[model samples]
Target: MILGHTIKDYKRENLLHDVITGIIIMAVSIPISMGYSQIAGLPAVYGLYGSVFPIILFALFSTSPQFIFGVDAAPAALVGSALLGMNIQSGSKEALAVVPVITFFVALWLLAFYLMHAGKLVNYISAPVMGGFITGICSTIILMQVPKLMGGTAGTGELLELLEHIEKTAEQINLPSLILGILSLVVLLAAKKIMPKFPMAVVMMAAGAVLTQVLPMKEWGIKTLDAVAPGLPKWSFPNLMLIPMDEVVTISLSVAVVIMAETLLAENNFAQKNGYRINDNQELLAFAVGNLVAALTGCCPINGSVSRTAMGEQYQGKTQLMSIVAGLSMILLLLFGTGFIGYLPVPVLTAIVISALLGATEFELAVKLWKVSRTECFIFWGAFIGVLLLGTINGVLIGIILSFAEMVIRSSKPASCFLGIQPGHKHFRDLAESRQIHEIEGVLIYRFSSNLFFANAGVLQQDIEQELERRGNIKAVILDASGIGSMDITAADRIEILYKSLKEQGIRFYITEHIADLNEQMRKLGIGYLIEEGCVRRTIYIALKDMGIKRPYPLEGGVDNEERSASRKRVDNRMQEFVWAFGSDTEDQIERQIAQQIKQLKQNGDVEKLLHGSWSHMEAFDEDEWLEHLEEHLKEIVNISGKDERTLAARFEEHRREIHERIMKEHPELAQRFKERRHRLDEHLKERRPEVYDLVVSLRELEKRKDME
Candidate 1:
């Protein structure tokens, strides 16, 4: 029952890797932590304090081994915004006193959430909403740092106010500070783009420290981190009397939600990448303890750092040992390195902070969502705008509300399409795609592409009724339940009403391709008897056959000789068009080449290996048309040999192996390149045709093993 039990099976080599990774992470965390602390309205050094004990606590108790908990921007920004709204000044005794109180209350809220089994609350907030909120936070953080970057005090308020403050302070900007800040920003951005693996923030900070020492920074009116206190942070408890209890509770609850959502996302992402799992409840407990410790130590609230976790993974960190190393390294910095850090220019740190925040903004995701689902795009923008105008807590609230609204609207208006048989295909397709599709003279096939729930049950009925009215001669209606994975009572009732109405009109109603559970639900709801006997069929083809409807052919096979002849004539016309479009000369060459290869296969008694090689060489011809012709020729061979379709299919598979082996032997270099190209194609296909891509990949892997043998 111990959390992060994977640590028990750790190897020495993994330990060594983790030790080095831990050290690297510590190097990165220190300056970033200080920057985040400034965002949290605390002295820059409090960032380091937050990173230390909270990280150790999280590492000890968290279920996720790879997740690096620290002073992340979102929570710190939220805390700072809330405090600023309450008129508390950043880096003041009042702000310092209030932060720990808020941190303590956040810890309590997390503990409450843990007890209530609220780990799944993160699921309620959709990806688009989270992306928009983070983007907004990034914008806010960047704007807040502009004044600091210009050698002025950090601004307070929302996006507009911050922008206004910057404009008002434009005349007071320090030239030297501005130049150094811009230079630091350039260095950080370039490092990120050109050498992502390098610790650009640390490098820039070091460079700034060296520059500050060599240059007369004080005389030039350039601000530097001159007051950094030496030695490690001492233990201190939250002074609850310093802030109103109601204000503390409200801010704590808001901060806790953001922390939980962000941390869980990071944990799940890393766990999935590493082929492991983390218990969500245990993660909550870990953060709760970590935050509690942060409160006790008078530090900012902590959350999982996605960037830091990625760094750990990049360095091959194996366990929580990396976090421990990071914490100890921060300790070393506090005890021995504060003197060097004190010489670091404030403008350089501001640039690091701005660059980091800007990087966190997800413009790409917003654009992608815009392309795929406009509603999700709206949700993202709404959340982002809310954060900018209304502040973090209210922005997130608005986003959550909008997300749920969008979900409801989508479910209430599901996509229902009338299906018709495509000209050269056996299965039914959406009627909208092709006007040439054949609709059965007295039948209608309808498909609803969503779960049949209470919200959309009436919509389903209306769509079916509309389709029935449009298809005037419909004697039978088949509901393609392949896409309807589940149904609620209201949907079931609506379906029953539709069936009764259709039956009254002398139209036969049938359901096909639904799971057994749906049928069971129907039976339990007293509508089972209506579909039990001949009313429900396993497939659309079976339903048509049972209704004595013969499939039209030349399209698929099995037809009367007269119909077959007409179909063949139509098929011949279509084939001529395809051949002409592809150039008849090229088609003829490909046909002759395949014929000659098959003939050679027959002579060598290896006919089973005929179609196994790369079809890329025959790219001059249309692949589908060529494959159809090849199949027909193969069928002729099967007829002459007295073999069945199943036997032919099995032989073709063997032939595929033979071709693969021959390619590896005679053209090994090309075969390797083909394999690599196929891998890239497989990755591309995953988004377009996941099932087909998976099957193809498995088959290719099997062929690869055969080639190896």
Candidate 2:
């Protein structure tokens, strides 16, 4: 972890506190590690040994400040699965010898992962999947031990088979073991509930010991673990010749993936909780060392333990000293306190494991998931089932795959809608749903609602091309990029191609305000400089103003009537085309609807009919009347959207004013004719309010220019 070497606030008093915290963590970890060893099908003493030197080494060299590195349930279960798979008898010398080799393999795998920088790969595992998987693992771990907790020996197999066996033989459950299991489970649960800072596992173990001595369960047919041999760890080297190369490599690969994931998770989580920043590479190295120690010291593969780290946090342990203390405590237990450990009941260990797994399920995360999406909740549950039924690896993989599939589906069908200005407001919105706005002529503005990435680059290019093709007269195309934040190389190349295509066609290509990083990248590609500098508008308002397009003012004289008339006509034309092309679910129905509106308008008095008519019902109308009403009541539509006509008018003027001024200046001799035309334009705008005219005119102008070329 990024626990900086700079000691900004170290104190002697805090050091003492760390020591006290370490001792408590050590005391708690000792019993747990010993118990975990039993879970691994190893002698309890090896668990105790595994917790010692490895913990000390990791504490000193590990990145996380407060992470308590030691033997964990995941690695233990993995080891047991490997041993069983290899047909190695649990207590055989060969089984014992294979562990070191496995540990060495796990360590190397971790080192490789670190070198490859695969830490961020976990981000692809969606939150829902993780929640489901962890919860499932917790439930599975609990269920798997139910038989043992009740004092019965059952061989592992498929989850369903094991569960079926337990259910079929419920009556065979030993009453003494059941009572012990229930008692230990209850104590551990209660300790966590009432005093979480206290070592609940240790307390439960002590309770188990007390119950064992006071009412010896063995006499009553309750099973107990045999006495474990206690000693300092002896170095063990793998006998390469004794093991087949294929078996060793296969087992190593499997164990490595499991251990690497487990340790990296623990190290990162611990560092995050303790305000330390973890270096993924450094963490892998530390785990590599930890694994090496576990191998040579006659123990199963070790990984980061979330439970032990939580214990450290609860007890205010925030230094490697905690790990040292915990390690030393285990050594002392081995050297002189071995007899005391024998008194601990097997049920108590099972209780501790179950309870810890329950805590690790991340209940709070599920609550948060509910707020994100119901689909995510479904994913979570699916992964949870996968973990429970299929095991951790398979379950996690399923979740990841499902999440990725969801992303691809969404991106493949990203949202695209016509950009319409609020009826009287400056802000643009989706034309289909909003009553307030109209699509502008000579300007095709669109916003793509997802990242421009390799997966969706083709879609983006097609969508843009289709929009431009539909409005072939567009003078400027502004891409509203607020929704987009990232782009892949393919997407960048596609954008460059579109830019050059637009430029060749004399249609200015512009990107509006976008993410800074994307803007820089586009600039680096020289698209920024190649395009018209003024055309690269930062916002919708700026783009419209720069283009000199303006909305007509009612009963106002300052505005140029002809220009407003032309603009209104263009807007009407686009609306008609949009409605014709992609607006309605059915073309025949839309045509019928339009016909009905025209018939109704002819039959009713203007104010009376419109005042009472529902907008959706009145959608069908003659183009002339529809355009006139749209322009006249544009303010009303905009007002409903909480904006006014002036804002929209100002934006429109920003785009069209320059061209208007230039035209007037260029033809001084026709000033009088222009003035008369402006009045005629005003009269026409109020009466016609044509939707398709402006779009048609813009397209005609482009066609005329192309003919000149």
Candidate 3:
């Protein structure tokens, strides 16, 4: 559980990618580890030493598949500051003696954290906070490296120190170093588009080394890394004599906590981005082993290196094998390729590091938040700015606080709408977004779009009250409880108060369109009276019907904001029940069926057969109504088919006998129903539509004469 999870499904195709990624990581690690090493008050080579063993140990033990582990900024800076606080000189012999002991104690604290399951703390940090924290870290480190690209040493500390360092470096202006770094950055950045899988970071690094060898290094005064002494990292016990036990324990615990917090958050952030799972407890175990290796190698306390890990991910590293290969590659460099490190230009290396960090920054996340939710955007920037001004831990804290505040604000003022019944839709919709939707006469339907909790109960009540005031003659108020999944005591009590108030005003109050489970929830919350009093119904339609309100539920002043055409409204008026069922789509539905029926008529020369067989009219409860709907489209049907009205009438008369025969053959009940209740709608059709009425009457009379013969 603590290791080799990625290897269980190790992909063979990814071997070369991981190997090349390992080489690239080792190359990038040279400058970063050295920079952090100096910050931790150790010699540059110790950073390299720390990289080899700790990474290998992490690969063996870490549940994280691709997260690169080694010396990182937070723990290194903590160690360096601890040395300063204790009045010990940095990079001195006494400092060297004390640092490993500190690392050893840090490892012990991590072991304790593992036992306590402290890694679960990451579960509370939101995605926006994690993304912003990562972006801030990447930006800060990139700013630190910008000075090196302009011919100065890598800057330390926060945004202010980095800006100051860049300004100072700009003042001196090493022309050759600046040009080389910029060109290198251009190449690395350009490679991603031109050849994404080309391993350009390594190619640029090798080219930088070859440039230093071929070109004059001292003449141009280009900064390159110092030559590392060829030796393997020795397993040595820490000498604790240089610091008091109490001070060491205090400082080491602080270092360990920062390492654990910063690294675990970054690691889990990566895990989330890549769509994998991490066992938080086992991740702590990995941290313990990695730092123990750091202690044995006489290096600063180790943590997950976000900069290096981001670089590895950019190059498409897969599996823990990337970590093993990186460790092995570092070992090979220390033993045999140590002299080659002297020829690699700092400007070119810095450019590569800066470019990699640029890719890692979450600019897209910030922009998306800006577009969709302004409050979330504020939370993101809060974390990003906090990291630059303060540190990683404080940055995460600031974002979390902002997220909680936003949640509270949103819950207190959740979405609510006064709904109007659109003619064609079974469910009501928001009045603002609808056309030809009617608010029922003396009836108000309200919807609240979040769970009814203590914070948002007033919002629900307020929305209903405003609508009731606006329409003073309201007889019934319907709460569409579809959006209210459950309610708390405050909300339940608020509802009771609302019902009493509405009753006092002679308006009936009802709750409908919620799950049956919600009724049980209301009962448990002491609002069961709403249910017992027949105020809770299964649907808004039933609730209105029970209140003596019926179809086309007459609106306050006809259809409010009636956008339907006059001709279309006439069609709707003729088919009021159909419009009530199918809404605005009724005309289109009828026209399409008539179009389909004409095609069938052209082929079969049958009118009655087409009507009975049409799947579109299958939902009609009454055959008379279905025929009436068809008759409405019959004039267009005649014109589109190039048929005379008299000829179509003759066909209808002739098909009436075939309809009887077809019905007797297939279903006797349909024949009996047709005989019993035929021509029922024709009575109204004569008054409303004389042309259709006359045509239908002539057709039926012609059929009757033929039957008498």
For candidate 1, what is the lDDT?
0.73
Per-model TM-score versus the true fold: 0.66, 0.66, 0.70
Which is superior by lDDT, 2 or 3? 3
Q: 548 in model 3: Cα distance from truth in Å?
A: 8.0
- Runs in model 1 lying further than 4 Å from the true structure: 1-45, 61-67, 72-101, 236-248, 265-280, 305-322, 370-373, 401-441, 523-709
lDDT of 2 by residue, 1-709 (tens): 3233413544555576566666656655655576567656677678778888888878766767777788766677778877887787775777777777777777777778778877777656665675676567556656666776778653244468568867854768788788878887888778788987666665666777787799957887666555667678888676656567787777777767766655564455445434667766677778778888888887888877766665566556666766777788878877887777667677767666667666766667667777887667767777777766776677777777788877887787778666766434445677677544566767777888888877787887787789888767778788887778777777888888888888899987767656546655555555534322444444555455556655531111222222323323222211222232222332443344444544565555232333222222121122223333334444444444344555433333332334345445544444454445445644775455444335334544765797799
Ranking by TM-score: 3, 1, 2
lDDT of 1 by residue, 1-709 (tens): 2324645676678777677777767756655677678889899888888878999889999877788999876788788889879999999999888898999999999999899989877678887777887678668767877997788876656888899989877888898889988998898788778976566665776687788889999898888764568777778787788887888889899899888876775566456546988888878989899999998888989988866776676556778888888898888878888777668788887786676666666789889998999999999999999989987668878888999999889989887787777654566778788766656667788888788888998987888788777668678889888878788888888988998899899998888766656666776677765542457655676567667775462221222222233233221111222233224254564576567666666566555444532232221113333443455465555655556755564454454445446556544544565455445544655665565445545665776898999
- Candidate 3, residue 590: the lDDT equals 52
Give the better candidate number (1 or 2) by lDDT.
Answer: 1
Runs in model 3 lying further than 4 Å from the true structure? 1-5, 108-124, 236-257, 268-282, 420-443, 485-493, 506-709
* Reference-based lDDT, residue 195, model 3: 81
TM-score of 2: 0.66
Cα RMSD to the true fold for all candidates = 18.6, 17.5, 16.7
lDDT of 3 by residue, 1-709 (tens): 4344556777789999899898889888998898899899999999999889999898888888889998878888889988898887888998778889999999999999999999898887778888888999999888888888778888888888889888988999788999999999888889977887788888888888898888996588789998889989888888877678898889989888878877877888889889998888788888899998898779999988888888888889987888889899999999999999998899988988888888888989999999999899888899999999898778888988988888878888877778787764455678888656778788898887788888889888888898878888899999988888889999999999999998999999888877667877876788865654668766677677668775555766765343443233211112223333334554565556566777888877766565553432232222345556666667766766667878765665455556557556544545666565455656666766789878888787876897899
Separately for all candidates shown, the number of backbone clashes (residues 3 or more apart, or on different chains) is 3, 34, 1
* Cα shift from native, residue 694, model 1 (Å): 55
* For model 3, the run of ten residues with the poorest summed lDDT: 569-578
